[model samples]
Target: MTGRRGPTLLSLGLNRARDTVTAQTPVTDLDEQTARDELARLAKVLGGANAAYHTSDDPVISDADYDALKRRNSEIEAQFPGLKRKDSPSEQVGATPSEGFSKVTHAVPMLSLANAFDDTDVVEFDGRIRKYLGLDGAAALSYTAEPKIDGLSLSLRYEKGELVQAATRGDGTVGENVTANARTIHNVPQSLNGAPDVLEVRGEVYMSHPDFEALNARQAEAGQKQFANPRNAAAGSLRQLDATITRARPLEFFAYAWGALSEPLAETQMGAIERLNALGFQTNPLTIICDSPEAMVAHYRDIEQQRASLGYDIDGVVYKVNDLGLQGRLGFRSTTPRWAIAHKFPAELAWTRLDSIDIQVGRTGALSPVARLAPVTVGGVVVSNATLHNEDYIAGRDNKGDEIREGKDIRVGDWVQVYRAGDVIPKVADVDLSKRSKDAPVFEMPHSCPQCGSDAVREPGDAVRRCTGGLICPAQAVEKLKHFVSRSAFDIDGLGAKQVEQFYADGWIAEPADIFELRAKYGSGVQQLKNREGWGDKSASNLFDAIDDRRNIPLNRVIFALGIRHVGDAAANLLALHYATWDAFSAAMRTAQEGNPAWNDLLSIDGVGAVMATSLATTFNQAAEIASIDRLVAHLDIQTAARPDTAGSPVAGKTVVFTGTLEKMTRAEAKARAEALGAKVSGSVSAKTDILVAGPGAGSKAKKAVELGIETLDEDAWLELIAPL
Candidate 1:
């Protein structure tokens, strides 16, 4: 990997003797096996880098280089999200706290920020925030854009205007208490004025450029190793065990955020930061209100231009929703706020030669084409594979009728521009047509599934082309099995995606029903799951118990676990309410072919439409599908679906169909009244129909009701029966 041409990925210290077989393999172009291999290496590298920067006051890589490593790791995790290792670097926040400090557990966690590396990401961040708050695209949103300090995050607690505690933002939950070291810093006020009884000020402890250079000069004269950067210097100075030594170091603090407050700070983000500044804390002076992405980006650019002269290091600009009320509504995801994002400057981009194009099947059977590139460095990370969203993305057109890549189609053997940013997968931003060979191949999409040889279909108006093989395809089968035990489905403990995939590969389980018979089939056999690698006796026992716990599943879980098309959790719940039980729903679906009366009954369910009804009918009516359903049902007791509390309503859970004109009540009025009592009002009478109301001029419907042996009532009788409710 490192001859006269110079090293690429192997230069990142990932070089290995065994890795020489395919030393050119790009980090981004990964199979599960290789991803695991690369993730382990990255974890070790990043952990060491964090320690060297945070604890030792030394660094192996520049801040830009370290960020790129994290970004590359994030990209790999995104590609194989389900295969995330336990020791993945993305899950960690910072290095371990230095010894000799008392640990403090924060009541409210100090979370991290998700990053947006380019203008497109900034626009997307705004859109995602609006979507979460149920705001329209045209809605006016105010945001506060501030410089993101490249320093250690610290939390300072004040009790009735008196400084009480100080700690680092360690792992977002707990940290080492550095109250003594914090008091030594001049910027950290020992007492506050006009502040709440309890307030926790969260900010960054940093050193300015002049102070950093001065401190390094002093260290050099004292015959001590100089610090690498201001951030490292500030972190090391603040965490020192000796208070006098920390007091001698020149460090500063800027209040940007808070953790806990007894009283209201302000209505908006800008107001709160201003209040903090008024309360004798130094907040970043460049903080400004930006009402739109254009304003935010303008401010970001201004900060980037002035970055060199700011005297402190700043990696990016942080934009947060201004209104506290809106922030509460937007809330948090995992460890980051959805309402806020760190909009960094555009990452490094480089030209790489296109190696080839490969089509891969996703969990949903969508055949996504990937561009395999010749290994090249982009933004300090090795670039190998870039996502070609679909045939159109490869062909340079978006679904919205806009031209991307300047209306150019990417061809094999062409030099392409690869762009990588924080967490986003590296993409072919543009193609270099001048470098394209005259005979470069134009990639064509396959008509059949690559895995199962089934028809691959691109539905009308859909950007993605999907395989139609259903459970027959191994990819679809494994994904469906994974979905069945997903958190929203059966939620069988100890059974995750990895386990499901392994079992499927080993032929231990092929479908949902096969999971229940594991004990009977392999309990005493020579081939047993407990005997497999990465499995133990206790793990096998726990898995079996977990499976047994879900034997009697709720109807909604059952419906969701089936992985039916167009029937999500809400639709499944609606079907569960209307049918009440699996047997009832299955019988109705078996009888519902195309336009049968049972099909109409299924369609009449609230939220159930033609698309969902047709898909459900077709799925349940298939002989193979029904047989599989029957086998799964045989091992357990099927719990009846619970309806919303309607015990007081006399007509609750009743199926009523009205026919002909009513004398007392209008047909619409009668239907509304029955539905209000939780009754399923149908347009046609079927075997499932409980009662049919007949009136004057009733003809075919009345005779059909009688033929079906459904109880019939007159319009007056129907009015009287419903009147009691």
Candidate 2:
């Protein structure tokens, strides 16, 4: 049958016979037509699975099977081009790159919910809803009160019952295409069980409590950095470049709203939620139907009381108008909805003793005082310390000149109110005078640095004191080294926090210069590194290679890695663009300290304030610090500055913004290629923008560019402009 028919039969998971009508016919025999039919069926099933994996956070098929089936379908399509279908899995890009998260004009604008701060606000919301619907005060409205999840907002698009696109809520109008990462989430459905032909569902992508704990445990065990909170963890995980990595992490999703849809359900909003639930999507169970704003406020109180008990993280309760018709009438603001409001829960608070006041030296030598509190759990994490901010914050009193917390001062043995602001860091909200002991000593700012005992003084008009000892300060040195090798900083592979600490403890490294000299001192000549526990020949070699690979670093990255005070990535990039070379930057810093106008100009750069400028100047002014930097420079090879291509380059060094749909390549791809060729890509078109790459359906960005008189190019014209260069 194989020779008589063709490869189609053989490729359809069937055994073939050499001769045509044989006595022993294959039991799994499939004719040409049957094979084609079966192949299409299999493709559809696999595609559905792929969509499930991508659209819904949960996956039903194994990775091995998915890969094999995809490969088989590819082979079939290659052999039978005419048989190829429009929705072939082979044609789809498996994952979207995270770089350059361009704006996606939402089919239906994603509006934010109005916020209700208190019970009064809730009552007002209820009155407005009833007034709009022409309902009597006595008319009760059913409401579904649910915990408002604190996580990343996403929109999933489905076409013909299959998931097509998933996007982040970037600036409302645009968002990063995180479809691949979103697929890894188990709760996000790849294909609806009984989905509509076209549907767009909005959901909150979160990391559950148990999953968050396990993730943090793994992070701790692996010695990798841990997330500050679950919301941050979920956001960071969903934005990962590799979707498979996202799949490995614990992520959850709950459908809360809808965008563009082809059909309508019952008149009420609750009916639409029920429909979503029937479609196998996970919706928050806490949702309640309330008839009036008074009932909504009651529901908010109930949810707030159960906030700690709920396994998932929720910042507040979302109250939406039940009737769809009324909702349409209510309308919306620029970025938020008018028909709904978010009722926030009261802040979590705890009382603890102020054991002591200690100063911590940061990487920038800023001495920040911390209130050492008795161990207490304010939100979830244990609170042992709270930021005192500065001397003024500690000394200032109420308008009456009495102590703020009932005449109590921040001192040892004084009870302090520890409050978790937005579930982040615990801060000393107030001091309790009634509980303050007679022996409670008044706290005073330290005269010397806690780490190095260098003269610590508060500068004029500055609230916080700073350590003058730059490189000699132990705390600052350790933090600076850690920051230099952090993932977002230099990204020096194999040189994580543990390794840095180990190297520092071993007396092998004291400054950044010592890192580049590790291979020279411990390479083939020494066996110490290999003999050390957890270190092997292969690991050592890999580490050495990773270290070597980072020798030629980008100027912007190098600037960031220097651990300069208040100099983040954006500031570093700005500095690199302005200076263009390390020597130029160094010279500028020195001249700035010497009162040069150019130095003052550097200080005048946006986001670079007088304090940051002073710190930068102070860092380079000392001869010892300069000598140490020179030594570090001697041990490392400075990367050559990339010269902007001036020959036939119309867009080189020009700032460009892209908007709408492109025909030749994806917006992400275009932006990446343009950046590689030495063009700056800005999210918004401003006066500094030189060119605007407008595609079909260009929106406000293009309009702004035109208004500013910036040159504009269409998709084809953009391709043409870059083609000559």
Candidate 3:
């Protein structure tokens, strides 16, 4: 219910304050610190969700849940504009392309759409568009309304009226090339007549309900796993490495939009869809032009009513400005277009009894509470478990001691309302206090680890309680080892999560270093791995080979594999690039633990916050962790972080900071361009900063840079300097 877009999506606005807080807190009530923390958590959660949905063709969270969190993040950023994070969700599109497929760079970025949850939100969306276009309430504004297909986005490129290539929208800018598999889709046309010389037709690749059910029946008969949903099935079928397999599956395409065109397709959005339909493409029949917001909302309601009978799944309805000229004038925000919005259907709710509350410790030692529910059908799925978020959630209080759920605590044996909307795991929406028994016990979080009995401590300004046992705890240790071999980490082919658990249970591999020692210890002896129950001689040999392959890993991968608290792949990459080498980074961490200047150095590296730095230092300073890391390093070759090809750029290897309002582009774009040219883009201007790009109303950072005698350049000068490329 708040205004969505800010002037800058990724700019480090005013001074940032940091504190852990829950997403349930109202935007109007949140302080700057809480807003910053909420943004950080949202960024991480959304990043992981995007990767799960796009890269793996599997979603971890439901669409409704994701939208709520994203909307909360946007509202918070709107209130505390200066606290926008560099890794803000508004700056990210889809996930990075997965492996196995060749990469393709989209000619035009495939951005996502903002969501309108309710009728009021939709009305506000229309109001925002009208206000932006200088139109009053009386001004006529037509929009194209259509079902937002719950399917994978695909772009088909045709040159000279011949189908050339097709790509999946991966991270918006770069995508995965699925040309062969796309050609097998029944609705896809091999050629286009009366089309532009070059055309990039954008649309959704989906599976109809009949097709999906049939495929699942075939899969069950063949002793294979049934698909979770139609969307996943379509994505998996289209991304098949074997085109023959894709041909065997039922997949369809619905052309709805255009990306790049040699000439204009149409003057209006509805006209463009008609033209695409004429050009041998299957456009949605439900797509219509609405003269007003009321008409658009009415169409959305009609579509929602017809959702069950539509054959294909549609999570929401999308409304786009019909006039091409007005759309161009509206332009775009960082990750979404201002001229369009998705009006989503409400989440489905069902009442179920809360069986019990269970605590599960993660790799990072945080204790997560889950609600065990009686089997109930919600949105066509039998959901027996729901996320409780944290202990505060169960206690009906947020991290800031603010009341939530009307200050009603959830209790076991109570009938809870579960809701599911395109979610793999449903959540408890409300507690039925009338159904609760007087003898029902209030759920309480354990002060000790359930797995290892380690002292569970909840720090100030932190939401979740953490086990202090470190690597000693069995749950944390096993999960940490699993993280070490994840796809982005060492990625030992023969050693997956199952294998890691087995090896740990067998007392063969304890830490990451133990993996590299397997060949030397168990290659030829009576205790060989070939003698194991599941592993064969060839499998053992291959496992060793895979371990050997990762002996020489990149610094970023190494840092991520360590699984230090608060240090994810992005943070690891930043640290790796900042330090360049493992020795420099490790030594710096060690020095920083002694309360020296190295602490400031670590803090100065843009994106490395105090909490993350403390975690790094704590990991390095711990004697047990150091020994483990030393052993691991002894068996591996750690490569230095590689720099971009900066051949002649003057700013290459120099630390540059941008401050205040930028006129040329979004702050994210400017930072990306600078990094592409091999310049280090830092958030704060420090003594080590080589240049400061200052715009109007440049604040403390600019003044500090001036006092420090760092080279200062305005927007025009900075652009000119980096223009020659």
lDDT of each: 0.78, 0.70, 0.82
Per-residue lDDT over 385-436 for candidate 3, one digit per residue giving the tens place of the 0 to 100 score? 8899898888888878899878989988887877753344578778768768
TM-score of each: 0.46, 0.50, 0.50
Candidate 1: tens digits of C-alpha lDDT, residues 1-725: 00001123333442231122123344444568656655666677667666555545454553445565677677778988887778776777666666668888888988878888789888999899888888898899999999988778999999999999999976678788999999999989999999999999999998887788789899998989786557768888998889899999999999999989998899999999999999999999899999889899999988865654576767679999999999999898876888899886544454667789988876568889998986543432345688888998888899986899889999888778777643247788888787688888787889899899999999998788899887789988888889889998889998999999998998988989999988788864323767887778788788888888999888888888888878897687778778999889888988886677898898777668898887788888788778888888888777897665666876788899886546466567788788777887887778888999975335566778899998899877877776767
Model 1 stretches astray by more than 4 angstroms? 1-29, 346-725
TM-score of 1: 0.46
Query: Which candidate tops lDDT?
Result: 3
Residue-level error in angstroms, candidate 2, position 693: 4.6
Checking candidate 3 for backbone clashes, the offending pairs are 13-82, 14-82, 62-423
After TM-score superposition, the amount by which residue 23's alpha carbon in candidate 2 deviates from its true location, in angstroms, is: 72
